[model samples]
Target chain A: MRKNYFHPKNLDGVYSVYQIEGLNQDRLIKNLKNGGLTLYNVKKIANHKMSLEISVKQDKNFFAIVEKMCYTNLELKPKIDKKRKKLLKKGVIATKSECGYNIKLTRVHGKAYPLYYLFTHVGVLIGAIIFCLGAYHVDDYIFSFEFTGSGNVVENRVVEYLNSVGVEKGKRFSEFDLNVLADGILAENPLLSYAGCLKRGNKMVIELVLAKNGTDILDESIKSLSSDVDGVVKELKVYRGTPLVGVGDKVSAGDLLVDGVISHKDVQIETNVLAKVVVLAEFNYTFISQFDDRETHAELLAIESLNLPVEYSKITKQPDKDGYLYTVTLYYNRVFVAG
Target chain B: MSFLESVKEIIGLEQFPAPVFRATIIGDVAGFFEGVVDVQTWSDEQIVIRLKKGGFIINGKNLYLKKYCAGDLVVCGKITSTQRI
Candidate 1:
């Protein structure tokens, strides 16, 4: 058995040790002696068929060496710490205890190149590049715009107006300031009662509430009309058009009371006349009731396959029809029937 | 590829075409061995199986065959060592 410190191939100053479990000691020792690693010490713990510890200097192909040793005892676990490379690079003695062995590397003034240190720096650089790519990447600019609550105004005209003011579809999200764009839209269009611009991911949602034009009452093209029910006109007030009926006059349904045209200075001017005509009427109403009660038919059939077994099932007959009829007079008046 | 093979791949059918002996150890408590030719030994302390290429011996405590169907077998226990010969 070699009792001296073993020098590992491809590594300087830094060394490693492994504690392998559930492996044959004689077979492992023989393999290690021929495996080209400078073996330092081999120790057996108290428990038989339990654990073995081996220490050696760092090797370039340490992982490959461990994998080669793994097949002998299929369950053999060699614990190694790749993080010690950072500490070793800083010239600090680092020790890590694992399941199979304890690794201790001494501090040295000279530089020791470790594969783990190179891999760590390279991994950090790659990670930083990936983060930068994610932060700057932009996908799918705004492709469509949708409008809601734009009534009275023509839809195509509203779409055209939006397109004219740079609020059209296919525009990028970064291209416009939302608040400023909404304010500009409202300023340019006086017909909108409320206007809003919203960016929902890649879609622009535009909400528009159109202002109601109350000038319909003064529009000349509107024709005047009378009371809808037979009643005495209690009050009458006309704002623009000519009135065809006066107060206290009896009018029936479909009677025209106001005309949407006024004659002034021998010329007829057409305008929508605003008026309020209230009519008071009195009447009585009645309702009728009807009902029926009856019953019919009951049958049953049994079925089975291979083994015929009769099953007894209970059949219950329930009432098929039930409801109500209500008749009431709203006002005290004689009911008249056409004979 | 044939139409059936393409459809199977698309639907993620991972069954091997031929029955080949394979064994997988999950930590030290359980192992699943498939395509087992024969079981040479079975007990609470050890289990020996014959595979296509060689034989494997599993030594443990409280070992038992959890399941066996066709050529597949599952053994579970507090396993200590596994050796191939």
Candidate 2:
């Protein structure tokens, strides 16, 4: 669509700048014009050197004519357009070097942001927003649950207990209290020495530690007998010590039920004694739980290591007029420590 | 005219026109039909273009041959005036 302004009908119009050097350059111009090519702005700076503008579309014919005329040196440079020529006249470029361009900005006004980039790549911003929203929403609920120390615990029982306590799938993890879950699972399971509840991302991990059960050793090392659970006494027998709790008496765990210091004819003899006490009917608990490490599960482990008459305990929760009612059931009655 | 003839005339595809040398002079641009024989004098202030028979001395400031084809010459500069020789 671009036609030469001068020879609009004859010349190809696409101009290119070239430096031509040769002897008898005046003859070269005549020869080039005769060769069906248009030359513009031919400047004869010297007898042998002339800079000129020629249509690039006639490049083949121009080169052939130059070669035929024996013009040895010819170099092509970038054509300076009208706009760039105007800028050159204004001396906008204060310095020039080959390494790089150090642009000097001048007279820029108005406050603006790089909103062009955001507008150009809207899909990336939308995708990032969606990812963040998905992450935030997914974090509110636990997706999957994994069990450790599964060999000693029943998986179905754990799942059932979780569902019963409203800790099942699609439930918000933040809604259920972790400590309540840990203690609830710990108190119910006799074999699990520790129960830990931990939430990682969308997955719930429960770690249970199995207590090591051994034969009954009536070692005289145990100084006195202590109650292992908070429950009413079902039966009691004292062979070598006086019983401080009778039947139907509610005693808390860690309470000394039989004392090592007893009055033997007012002699104040201090010696270990043997006693047997049974609390609530024995029961077994199976559930999923997680224990982080030794330090955190110490309290749960301490309860199990006591090795008292109550080998395990279970807690059942119910809604009553006075908020929630928690019932503690002590079971797994073993022979009281033969202290 | 036919569509084909119009297209050729617009693209300069038709054969060259008659050789009667004519210069269409404008304020700063002067175009000539039918080429000059040779450039007798060329400078920033003056240009002497030789024709087949006679020539014209165009005296101006920054006068140069804007383009010169087989028989077409375009002279562009700040023209004070022109004279025939």
Structure candidate 2, residue pairs in collision? A196-A290, A196-A291, A206-A289, A206-A290, A207-A289, A207-A290, B34-B71, B35-B71
Which candidate has the highest lDDT of all? 2
Relative to the true structure, candidate 1 reaches a TM of 0.28
Tens digits of per-residue lDDT for model 1, A1-339: 764333223345433434444434445444444454344323333322322222223333433454444322222123234443443345343222222433222311123434433433576667777877865443336777777776424344466567777766666777788787777666666667677878776777778777675222334445675555665666666776788878778877778777777999999987766666655542322212132211111111211111222222222333333332222211111111110
Q: Report residue A212 deviation for candidate 1 (angstroms).
A: 4.6
Best by DockQ: 2
Of candidate 1 chain A, the 10-residue stretch with the lowest lDDT total is A330-339
Worst 10 residues of 1 chain B by lDDT: B64-73
- What are the lDDT scores of the predictions, listed in order? 0.53, 0.62
DockQ of 2: 0.40
Instruction: List model 2 lDDT by residue over A1-339, tens digit each.
Output: 996544322333345556654455567777888888778777755555566776555655776765454433232232223543354456542223321212111111112212322333578668878999998988989889988884234444566578778898788888998878978876666556777888988888887777576233557765678877666687677778667888888777787778777787878876777766766544333222233222323334434554444555555555555444444444654335464
